[model samples]
Target: MRPMPHDHSDHPHALLPPDPALRVKALETILTRKGLIDPAALDELIDTYENRIGPKNGARVVARAWADPMFRAALLEDATRVVADLGFYGRQGEHMVVVENTPQQHNMVVCTLCSCYPWPLLGIPPGWYKSDAYRARAVREPRKVLADFGVTLPEGTSVRVWDSTAEVRYLVLPMRPEGTDGLSEDALADLVTRDSMIGTDIPKVPS
Candidate 1:
């Protein structure tokens, strides 16, 4: 919805030069010279965020929504509270809005200004999500972006793009795959991918 004020000092970019490319070089030069930061440690931290702490938490939320109608209703009505009920809430996720995907309408989330994603639900924002290309094109040509991610919708389905802001981050509750009626919530969560939760892709169907 609206952009919210955020503290940027903790952001790595805030500590470096304005140019994204030069930032790495600058950080290396400065940190190395001062002996304040270790490259290996930094790499490990990034790896942790990118891999280990990913969208598994969000997948669980989606699984719950799919299994329980009341929880789904509450999630759609008041996402912040519903998600917090599951012990997931912090920073960018303080104010959240959950959009459901349907046969008629599909929803996508993007942050035009900056990467304001729900860390509690989705963890650290992906590299592409914060890239300038994705930030600009996701709003300009969402269908094309989706296509790039190998997601093609039917001609009749309408696409809605939700612009995320620092104030309110949005999450897409992707449609549950068919033939999963007998699957438990944990099993269902295994089918939910990070891209699916972000509306860039769809959930995987059991074979």
Candidate 2:
């Protein structure tokens, strides 16, 4: 047996339903009633973001950077232009900066104000990325946030948190997995997960 979810309408984070599923449903209903959104279009949009556009574009970028030193340097130096060169630039990704994760330091991205993200590369932002808890705690306790996301770093590794805004967005360049030097770029791209690009996880090594 399972207990029912309680309403948190009285809480400070009111307007946000207690359950995230319910929160999204409520928001959808409100928007639909106001004639601000169309249900069919919304469903199609979510489907496109989730399946068609999500992560694959970012994986291509990551794979290219891993296979080419020059591209990696250019990406880290001028992500906005470099990513646009690959045709992954749009509304939310106009001004982009890329951060590299190294042996000694890790980088994480968050937008405390709102859900500013690179839509062309990553598609729609995940629910947690826009949650109040993540927005508030990621900056204050990045290690804990990473831990919550099932990522653990060595004690000596330092974490750097990047705050995103309407003006500038960030893309995390996760370290290329070991033993992948011989893999083709397409195969390597398969190892790059959406969470890895967000700095919440790392690229998986092929079996």
TM-score, prediction 2: 0.78
What is the C-alpha lDDT profile of model 2 across 1-207, one tens digit per residue? 977677555665565788989988988898899999999998888797778776799999999999999999999999999999988888678888889999999999999998888888898899999999999999999999999999999878999998886678888999999999789999999999998999999999999
- Looking at model 1, which ten-residue stretch has the lowest summed lDDT? 7-16
Q: Where does the lowest 10-residue lDDT sum fall in candidate 2?
A: 7-16
Measured on C-alpha atoms, candidate 2 has an lDDT of 0.90
Backbone clashes for every candidate come to 0, 0
What's model 2's lDDT at 156? Answer: 88
Candidate 2: regions farther than 4 A off: 1-51
